[model samples]
Target: MNAVLIALLALPLLGAALMLAPIGDRQALRLGATVTGGTLLLAVALAAGFDHGDPGRMQAVTDVSWIPALDVRLHLGTDGISLPLLVLTALLTFLCALYSVKKLPAGPGGRAFTGLLLLLETGMLATFAVLDLVLFFLAFEIVLIPMYFLVSRWGSGKKTAAANRFILYTLLGSAVMLLGFLLIGVKAGTFDMVKLADAHGAGLSHTTQLVAALAVLVGLAVKAPAWPLHSWLPDAHTAAPTVGSVLLAGVMLKMGTYGLVRVLLPVVPDGTATFAPYLGAFAAVGIVYGSLACLALARAGAKGDLKRLIAYSSVGHMGFVLLGIASLTPTGLNGALFANIAHGLITGLLFFVVGAVKDRYGTADLDTLSGATGAALYGRAPRIGALLAFAAVASLGLPGLAGFWGELLAMYGAFDPAAGLSRPAFVTYMVLAGLGTLLTAGYLLIVVKRVCMGDPKQPAPVAELPDLQAHEAVSWTPLAALTLLAGLWPALLLGLSDPAVKHLLGGG
Candidate 1:
């Protein structure tokens, strides 16, 4: 088990290293796909071997002392909580690699692009695997460098500025988070996540725990980019290339929310209780804010970029996740976890479709691409249009899709919060969140009507353009299928998470 886990981390690094060996672009692409594919297989094996009945306990643990003086160990493990994310990281990275095989970003360094992607995969996988706070922090920070390079080097307009903003915001957040970790580490005399969470910061004074929790929550909220802090996301997504947007929305955003469930709630229960109401408020506000932003952009006629609008939609989806976390009930946490995976599949697919739109039409301009106004995309590229509509509907939380359960359950949690929480406050949040759902439906339907429904105003040259290329079909089919499968069988993911969440919340 230990060997398999180590191999999962090592394979990506090895692939990255090989990219430096004077490899040609074709070979580099091949190597990237091969490495990520292998990693995905390993992730699957890990899941197959997981003891689902005992998922509350970490499985395949590999613990060894690495820094004796500091009481930090080289611990790696996964529970039901981390397993889904682990698989998500592997699956998305592999798909990105496959997508790059034919549609490599317009950049000079194909080798560097593939290499950095592999490295990014390593950091993401490691972040979920590590069970030591210090090691987790290290793995968490490792992803920033490669992603910064990815955005700055390969992105479009104002890429450098966007990259700088992303780095500044995340680095500051991470620094504050580190301080919180250090405070708990010093007080507990160890950085083992399992021990710290089990203790629930019992060793620290109430005031100390509260202070540390504030610092940690603030830091994570920034990464989660809850409301005011989320300004960086739009620009970053707008400037980023297709694959960058896919991974950023699909995998990176989950890191902050994952920390909330994995680190904050368990390690500092008192702190989480103290701040839960306020967290719920912020989440509710973000939901409305994100939806309104999308509506305003949609109203902007030809000026709005589809990619940026999708980025705003992400903020709204994440608000549901945050609301679930703030509820701090087993049902809420389950919803949050389910939403995490659903967002990855649905939004990742959305980004891919948007990227293809831009690639084929030279822009993701709504008025220009809208079938009602310009190209009549459904008539020109029927397959791409159909796929885009499917992704958008799923994202809007349509019935019988992956996005439905999470939002529905989250609202339910807010309606009936945990035992100790304030009922009035959560009910208010529930109402607000319910309204946000209406807004979500409104904006998405508007987009669909404009882009997919109307007759061709000025039909694009069908012969020159293509719809759902071979590589794209290969990369997208699994996500589309899973969205339906999980929707129909919510238990597939919910079952895995319920026991673990129950254990965390002391329901066991």
Candidate 2:
């Protein structure tokens, strides 16, 4: 079991190395992604083997002394909370890699991009698994480096400037976050997250605790790229390569939401209560703002802003997670956790489709792209168009697909918050958020009409091509299946998360 834990973390690192090897063939890069996916299958086995009745506690426990003199240890395990995110990280990483098979740049430039993505995948697994705070922070930081390079080097248009902007903003936030970690370690005399969460801020003064909480929020909000701080995301997403866009949307942003759950809420419950409304306000604005921006972009018919549109979609989806968290109810918490995976899967699929469209049509502009959706065009690429529709509609929280419950449950929880939360305030937020959901529906359907409706027409006349190739079929079909599975049977996810939520809420 310990060995399995280690393998789960190591597999992608090894995959990254193999892809970067001098062999230098695009086929080999793609093959490497498939091989890495095999590790995810191993994770699925772990998930199946999990003892469902006892899913709350860490299972498949593995601990090793790494820096005992300082009380640091290499510890990794999964509870209900970590399980879904881990699975999502693996699924999206695999799909992102698969997407790379077709989405990469024309030459040697593509090779390094694949390697960095694999490394990012490995880091995400480690960050989600590590139980120790210092280790978690370290693993968390590891996810940033490769992604910075992925954006700066292989990114498009404003790649260097965008990457620099992303890094600078995150670094500023991370500095404050690191200070928060050190404060916890100093006050609690341990760097273990379990130890600290178990302590529940008992060792620190109110002022001290609040300061640390704010510091951590600064860093995490930058990553969550919350309102005012979210400027970095549009640039990064627009400039990033397709696979980078996939990983960034699918898993990296979730890191911030996860941190809020893992660190701020548990470690500083009072601080969280004080700041919850403020956080919710930022999130609400991001939702309305992101959705509106996408509509404007689509309306203006800009060719290059397509990926940015999807990026804004992320802002809107994450707002739901924030809403759920702010509600401070088990249902909302569980819903947010589920949405993390749902959004990752759905948005990852969206980027894949957007990438494919750009590859085929050379642009993502709605006006310019009108004829591409004609019936004959669908005849030519029905699979891709259908998949895009699936992703876009699901993103709008379509009832039967993977995206349904987060907003519904978030509002439910808002109306009936846990005993500690302010009911009236949260209810108001919930009502406003519900209205935002309607707006979300509006924009997503617009994208659907623009991209998937018209009869087929050749923009200027060109050779015909087939829908999703074998690799795409492999990557997208399973996500679609899981989306449907979770949509129909949310119990598959809520069951795992409920216990963990219970523990976290009780100040675990």
Candidate 3:
């Protein structure tokens, strides 16, 4: 089992190295698909063998001294909190790799694209798997390089500027986060996450925890792209290729929220308790802000870019995730984890569908897509239109979909936050979050109406648009299916995460 964990990390790195050898573009793509597919199988195996009875226990752990002098170890493991995200990373990467095989982005062939993607996978998987703070930071930072290249090289509009902004903002965040980690390591006497979490701020002073929490949370908020810090996401997502956008929304943003749960909460209980209200406040603001932004985009019609609207929607969705964490309760944490996975699937599929639309029409503008008049898509491409509508409904938190449970649980948790947090503040946040949901439904329904419900009276070029293709179907079906499955059986994820959440909040 330990070997399985190591292989999960090493396999993709090895495959990416092999991609550098002289090979045909087609062969490179095939190799990428095979490699990521194998990685996904390994993730499934880990899940199958995971001890559901003790989901809180770290399984398949690989701990060894990497720097004896500094007491830093090369530690890797997964608990219920991380297991779902690990599998999600693997599944999405494999699907993206498979999708790229058929629909390689322009400006680069299979070699550059596949290699960068595989490397990005390695970073993302390691971020969810590592147990040492130093190792975690390193893994988190490794993702930037490949992603920067992906956007600048293969992206569409303002690619260079977007990539530069993305890297600069995240790098600054990483720097501040590293400062927090160093403060903890120097004061706490070690950098091992397990030890720190077990101690639960025993040795650290109240002041240290407060400062560390502020710095760490700020850094992560930048990546979570929380309200004020989220300016980079829209441009980056709009410019990136389909696979790039999928991985960015589906996996990368989770790194920030995951760090909050896996590192901040247990490791800095005092700070988390003190700042819980503020976190909830900011989360509420982000929720409303993101929804309003999307509403503006949806109403833009021809001026709107579907990809950009989806990017704004992520801010609102991730706000719910942060809100869950802020509640600092077991149910809230579970909701955060559940929302993380749900967003990955629904948003990944949405990006894929939008990417397909852009491929057909050469733009994602609503009016141009539907025609100068209304109701052009249903006539031109019923399948794509239907897929868009389905994804939109799933994203809007419909009762029987994956999105509903998480937001519901998050708001419920806010209605009753942890013992020390102020009830009034949280209740206010809850009310605002609920309003954000209504706004969310409004914008998404607007999108469905404008993009999918139009008549079949489109012009000749619009009529010529192709329906969903085989490769697109293969890549997108799993996400749609899992969205429905998880929606109907919320316990599939809640079961794995509930115990772990309890243990984390209970101080191990």
Across 324-354, the per-residue lDDT of candidate 1 in tens digits comes to 9999998999999999999999999999998
In every candidate, how many clashes are there? 0, 6, 2
Superposed Cα RMSD, model 1: 1.5
The alpha-carbon root-mean-square deviation between model 3 and the true structure, to one decimal in Å, is 1.0
Model 2, residue 110: C-alpha shift (Å): 5.0
lDDT scores for all predictions?
A: 0.89, 0.80, 0.92
What's the residue-level lDDT of 250 in candidate 3? 98
On residues 98-187, what C-alpha lDDT tens digit does candidate 3 reach at each position? 999999999778898889999999999999999999999999999999999999999999999999999999999999999999999999
User: Of the candidates numbered 1 and 3, which has the greater lDDT value?
Assistant: 3
| Residue-wise C-alpha lDDT for candidate 2, range 69-158, written one tens digit per residue | 888888888889988898888888887777677656553465677777778988888988898878878887888889899888877787
C-alpha RMSD for every candidate: 1.5, 2.2, 1.0
Which prediction has the highest TM-score against the true structure?
3
Worst 10 residues of 2 by lDDT: 370-379
Which one wins by TM-score: 1 or 2?
Answer: 1
Candidate 2 deviant stretches above 4 angstroms: 18-21, 27-31, 300-304, 371-380, 458-465
The best candidate in terms of lDDT: 3
